[model samples]
Target: MSQIVTLQAFLDHWAGSDPEKAAIASTVRTIAGTGVGIADLVARGPLEEGLARIHGSDPNGGGDTQKELDVIAEEAICAALREAPVAYLASEESEDLIALNPKGQLVVAVDPLDGSSNIDTNVSVGTIYSILPFTEADRDNPNAAVMKPGTNQLAAGFLAYGPATILVSSLGNGTQVFVYDRESSEFIMARDQVEIPVETREYGVNQSNMRHWDEAMSGWIKDCLAGKEGPRGKDFNMRWVGSMVADAFRIFTRGGVYVYSSDKRKGYENGRLRLIYEAFPIAMLTEQAGGGATDGKTRILDITPHHIHQRIPLVFGSKGEVEKIASYY
Candidate 1:
């Protein structure tokens, strides 16, 4: 086996080997910096005396209630990226894109504290991010740059803060994972070239929204519910953590299908997850791990963004299962 190395050393080696790709190096540094900050916040836990408690209102109007940690994490991530070569920072908590350095070559979108609702219950939550290149034309118009398709992403990743703070990322290469070593105060490489299984008997979906689902989506779940006696020909386990990061981490470690599809509800025509910050980054990671991500009708990465906070239906996981879901569309 090859020797394990720290995340900094690994990133430095890549940066050194590709000296001309300054954006790549900068992205690496920025992600590492943000990951550290997020991990530190996770370790500290909720600060009841301060602003760590659940906020009374969500300033962004994303529909989800914002927690104090969400604002704190966003501030920390933005602070770290401010010094990096990032031209713009788009976040879930913010109502608009914030410009950092106009001359910078990259734009970053982030979900500062995903699944923040779980914070009160001590359930796992995380941070998700995507890095994209920006052109000279994009300097004055951050929205134009941020609205690019997920296929334009240069890099993407997520930090799952559970029993262990884990960082999984892809730099247009295969997905890799690192675990935070608290004693050494560094992220140590845990697994390199991680790939999801092609098939599995596990699945995740918000069954509570079954009544609102469209025919295609409802039919798929019906079959899964039928289990061995149905056409699927096997028993399948159902799981729902009400946390995308936690669900994604579980799929990464094992093999399972996760779906957050569009239902017939009034505001859910396009789904609930943000296309840029949530769906795009997770789709990139899924593809990197040999899995697949889609909206049942088209590849997730192929969908173009109309706005920063545009929502989309997300169905991703084991390649075979994802394909199966696509067939139903």
Candidate 2:
């Protein structure tokens, strides 16, 4: 835990030791660098007029009601990547693959704002990003570059802009956490490799959707609620923040399981999370930090994306707890 250094220093080390990863190091830097600006915008909140006003549904056909900050965050990352060595930019905010540097060797998938629905409420919202090596198998089809499996990711991370602006990432090496220092306007490494407790007594899920969940899902909650009075012999805490990043940060800081499962609801059979950007990056982070992520039954990183904006169920947290939930199914 004593491994303290500025993000730039870490990046320098990352690139200096391996020239082949220069593109990845630079891309991570670009994402985190622009993330600072996004943090400021989020901090401003109501100060920024119409920041949370509904901008209409996502033009990408994801059916998400877009907010002004959502577009702003997406554009900020897009503009920044134009200067980085990025071949293509795929986002949940956009349907088409954005061609950046044709010569760039990497493709970046992003969720501009993970919890934009909570923007107007002044709750925590963050950005998620996944970096993949560019594939030239289908030069004419730009979407092909983004259809790879999560295992193909060179790097994945998310910026949780809560009370503290922390940038969490993994370079396939391990998960690293960086805290933003306003004094220097830079991110400094705050934690080295982190490990989640194998077991936890706390859990998170949107209880409002309890009726939509199937028996396995509802039964699990019921057992936990039963505490020592029912099948489960211990008390458990239930938490729901209505934001993925916020819930994830809690699990990372402490320990817990968060499930956003595929329910019986119409059009939500595959779950609501976009696989490429949201699930992939979070899965990578969780795994890197000695946790696990799954779609109730399957490993998230093992799924090959069929489309750039594909949605899937998401469940991740303490490995033991995750396994327990999977056993229920």
Candidate 3:
């Protein structure tokens, strides 16, 4: 009998295949512009250089080191998939949808660099990606290129580059976590079948933004508060780390809900989280782990991405609270 390596195996292999390959790719000459595919992006230079740059010690005299990290991540992604054969590429950094290998099987959406604000503090940051197959007609509508939701993703994953760069991915069946073995230049399986325990207690929300919340959100929080002190008769804890990836990673490891929603704040029409980059990937991960993700009204995956960096409200985690929050909406 032949061994059947899980889909996660392939992803892990890729993660370790090229240690220095550019993680992101672009062709826009300026710091901000439009480009295509993964090959044209520039390399991020050395790992130590990236580490130093990430620490705000870069001598480039350019923009913030986070931007440089973003570019590096973008380049790394491009280099990693230069031959992986993906079709359209939608990213948080680019305004235009990039056409790469038009006949390829996969359409990839990425947040090349997540949690850039945490770089200064040496906190954990990550890369989120979602993969969908190219539909027959999707090839024509540039905007409709990657139309599937996170629920329909063939592969969903994130690479956490912090104290140690780790890869977390799903291959439809289950989740896997791989740690970078720098010496061997390979990803070693540190965990498998990463199931998020479904306990119902704590919840995460940014109370500082409470003034901008909608009736539904505020109403739900009121209920949670009531449970904590008033009537519902349960003690509740609140957490808001400001970084979606960090907040979500904690939820995945622990058990809880995280919310960032549409509020009355100016410029918050669609919400703060990016649909293609942040919400979808996390939503997919949450769902795959027996958790739930919603936009208060609809499933996160059901909301098709209209733009590369389109923002949307997000609420996800333990089934109970997430459902309860959605019920309020």
Best by TM-score: 2
| Residue-wise C-alpha lDDT for candidate 2, range 135-200, written one tens digit per residue | 666467777777877888889999999899999889988898899999998899888787888999
Q: How far is candidate 2 from the true structure (C-alpha RMSD, Å)?
A: 1.3
Over the stretch 1-329, how does candidate 3's per-residue lDDT look in tens digits? 15444323454454465422112111111111211111122222233344324434322221324456676666666655545556677777665666777556567788876776655455666777877666677767756656555666766777665555566666565666666655664556666666776667788888888877888888877777886476556878898777676777778778799998988866586788878778887888888888889989899988876555667889999987888888887
TM-score per candidate, in order? 0.95, 0.97, 0.78
| Sort order, TM-score high to low | 2, 1, 3
> Where does model 2 exceed 4 Å of error?
1-3
Model 1: which residue pairs collide? none
lDDT of 2 at 299: 91
Query: lDDT for each of the candidates?
Result: 0.86, 0.89, 0.66
Write one digit per residue (lDDT tens) for candidate 1, span 34-108.
Answer: 777666666666554343576757567757777778888888888888788888899998999888876678888
| TM-score, cand. 2 vs. native | 0.97
The model with the greatest lDDT is 2
Error of 1 at 230 (Å): 0.7
In terms of lDDT, model 2 sits at 0.89
Mark the regions of model 1 whose C-alpha exceeds 4 Å error after superposition.
Answer: 17-20, 46-52, 56-58
Model 1 score (lDDT): 0.86
Against the correct fold, how does model 3 do in TM-score? 0.78
